[model samples]
Target: MTDTSIEPSADAPAQLSTLDRFLPVWIGAAMLIGIVLGKAIPDLDETLDAIKIDTVSLPIAIGLLAMMYPVLAKVKYTRIGESLDRRSLVMSLVLNWLIGPALMFALAWILLPDLPEYRTGLIIVGLARCIAMVLIWNDLACGSRELAAVLVAINSLFQIVAYSILGYFYLELLPEWLGLDSDGIDVTMWEIAKSVLIFLGIPLLAGFLTRTIGERAKGVEWYEERFLPRIGPVALYGLLFTIVILFALQGEQITEQPWDVARIAVPLLIYFALMWFGSYFAGLKMGFPYERNTSIAFTAAGNNFELAIAVSIGVFGVTSGQALAGVVGPLIEVPVLVALVYVSLWAKRRYYDTDGVRPRS
Candidate 1:
């Protein structure tokens, strides 16, 4: 059996490279730089808008593809079917699909009742569940790589099916059912599905093929250590590039409407806390091992911001408040989830023994 557990270390942050360590800083810098460029260049948005692939800006689409590829490639496709019987997997599905989105819908409506576009954008973020960086967060907390990999693959597959359905439910049907006013998404379910197919399906297939072929030709060690390391940094570069272009497109709106950004953040902050802590303690009560618990918690808490950004831009124009709300997701998520790594560690010590087994109360 593949050893799925990450070896625990004293410094979880030390497990990360400097680039990952200062990710939020880099993203902030990218935003500032993009804003500066937008302010400097009078026709930046027009230039970006000139080219499009299925309603997404060509430049942003390129960046989104770049950002998603390496991360998906890191998933262990071979390990997917290994341990499907575990209760943790079922629990994770419930948290990710049912609870997570419903909570976001409630919070977005409750907190931003006046701002429909931003509200719709946050709902999209909630639906685009974690398939990317939760692996890093899980590993950082010394969680189960085997479970994380399997869970990610399952979530990735589930995304292609559930995202559009959930999008319609929350964005259109739910509001009308409850007598709440909604602008309603202009795009058809097919339009949303097409976006998902392009942005997520393409990268997911590429990543799976890359790993499968690379491992077959070169063996797992070289494929993982050498090739993956070389291409891994490309994900960060792509994310920053996308952010820069996104901010450049909406620099004036973001700068002029700073309070609007702040309002979007409040619901996100509450959502992250509620999901992470709620999942963690729920795992504890269910008597999950520490590693699996950590894995479930992070997986449940994180959002696929890359997919969210892509879909928002695809369905709503790049300049819309919906896209801006999607962009703000990672900006808030990165820092908040990073802090939760320490919180996970602290919970382990507080509730579980050194062997990662919880004590009976």
Candidate 2:
């Protein structure tokens, strides 16, 4: 029988390395390389664009699933119950589900009100919360690893249901409220459900099974120290490849409407900063310890762009403005969050005692 005992903890030093450290630089390079390749080779880009059935690119689907696998496999679903002690979990949940999506909705409307495609793209991005990367940020900020794991696990479970249901309503209702064209709002539950099932559901199941089987077969030490490390970077490698394909496919849009990328970025930038600080201050006001506060801040601020991009392409099209917005999300988020990792650490130092006490004032 398998031990089924592995769960991510804040206590373990983040598994980040030099390559992981420079992830943003590598992602940026991927974008540039994609753009150049798409522009330079017309036949290659056309061939990739044509390699799709049911509007989902085969290459992209493979890359996204591959990228997602390693990340999902590490989730310690077993530890979720114990990690729920902190009231701050409530704060993080509210931020992720209620506040975060609503804020993104308002920002997208306010910033890109007339541009429905772009607005819808941002809306898609807003609804999909971060599940995996927040763990990395949590570790970097010296936040509660246990709580981060719990929140991520909760989100991981919630998203398979919430993403489709919430997406259906938000995309449908919000446009009518704001008086934008309702065409993009016609996404069906089936579409959102299909995207979630393919993009998130498959990997989650695979992750659970892989961990269960591997631990049972090889014991914990070999599974953790050897097996885990080998598969750890698969998702990132897949990300680079997917980015290349996405940008290559949309090279024309990128080159012709260069400002579109910047336009999509505005709401994302505002969203990231606002979520981080808003949650940070809210946690402090509620008297959460620094550890819980940082966890809340990063969890609120980060997004699962992989799911967002996959869903956008599934629901919208690969070359859609929505997909473009989804692509731009991680592009802007990584660097911004990288800088904010420091901000979190500095804030930890400035406002909290070394013992995780919140400063008065």
Candidate 3:
């Protein structure tokens, strides 16, 4: 496979169609629609929540699968090994595991000191890491496709082992060590692992198979130019669909408790800015090219809202404040990450050379 991982072909914003360029608007509209639908229809949440695939709602699982498949299919899987950089991988691991969770823990405590449930929910969000939408954000920012694939793969496998342990530490032990009050959280490792396998594993396998079969039947050019574009729009549709469903399920809570949602959103905004900018600059300091650096930034910044919400609802009741906090995760993340995609493009122009390397000042 040819290595086009060094530089983005064109500035992302310029290359995007009108629909994609106005992604934030579309997302906002979806959120509003979901909220209206949820509020207007009695028992909408209960109805949506009726069907379940393990711990997650079946509609959500379907949306997640749809949201993930096209993006993963766009990855050039064959080149992931060839383009792998140990340094980038190490940085991603540290950001996702150590710095990311600790930052959320601190922010939650600092910002929402009086609200323990919300704090715990934010901490859970941090531990979950990004498996789903990072691919979309990374692709939108014109980041390295193969590197995003590799990092996401690493995160999925690592979360299966680390989520429960980290949950215990963050929720129970860390607070105790700090002489603070916290309730012990019971998180099943198998449930979390099952979620990862379903949400990520199924789509990943499908994406890989699609590419393998598609490429074998048709040439790479035909697949990349023709088939990929035809399917590309599905990703946006899936994303919009997921957002609508998520907001619909939690709409009453969000609209009713606007102030609380704002409170939850503040620390989340801080977390995304800190993670994305911090990771980007760290990669720049390490002399990484823009493509790899973007992958690092987005992968670090995004969290697995699906896993966090599932864990929260399973641990706390569906209407618990903790669950509301978990729902707020994507509500804040969507618009923010969409903005960062543009910001990444801006940084690319101002900071990076044509070859995607930031010149040494």
For each candidate in turn, give its C-alpha RMSD to the true structure in angstroms.
3.6, 4.7, 2.4
Minimum summed lDDT over a 10-residue window in model 1 is located at 1-10
- Count of backbone collisions in candidate 1: 0
> By descending TM-score, how would the candidates be arranged?
3, 1, 2
Residues 1-361 of candidate 3: C-alpha lDDT, one tens digit per residue: 1112223644546667777878899999999999998888888987888789656789888888888898888888888996678899899999999999999999999999999989988998999999999999988888888899999989999999999999899888999999998866788779888999999999999999999999999989888888888887788888889888888888898889999999999999999999999999988888998889999999999999999988888898777888899989999999999999989988887787876766445
Q: Higher lDDT: candidate 1 or 2?
A: 1
What would the per-residue lDDT of candidate 2 be over residues 1-361, giving only the tens digit for each residue? 0111232232222444656657678878998888888788876655985787675567877877877677556655676565566577677788999999999988988888778888888888888898655665665556665677667767766776688777866787666676656445445556555655666678778988998998899987897778767886776788778778867876667787878888888889999999999988888888787777887799899988767776777667767788788877877886788678767766766776656675557
> What's each prediction's TM-score?
0.84, 0.79, 0.96
Q: Please report, in order, the local distance difference test score of every candidate based on alpha carbons.
A: 0.79, 0.73, 0.88
Clashing pairs in 3: none
**By TM-score, how accurate is candidate 2?**
0.79
Off by over 4 Å in 2: 1-16, 43-46, 49-55, 131-150, 156-172, 175-182, 287-292, 314-316, 352-361
Two-way lDDT contest, 2 vs 3, winner: 3
Ranking by lDDT: 3, 1, 2
Best by lDDT: 3
Question: What's the lDDT for candidate 2?
Answer: 0.73
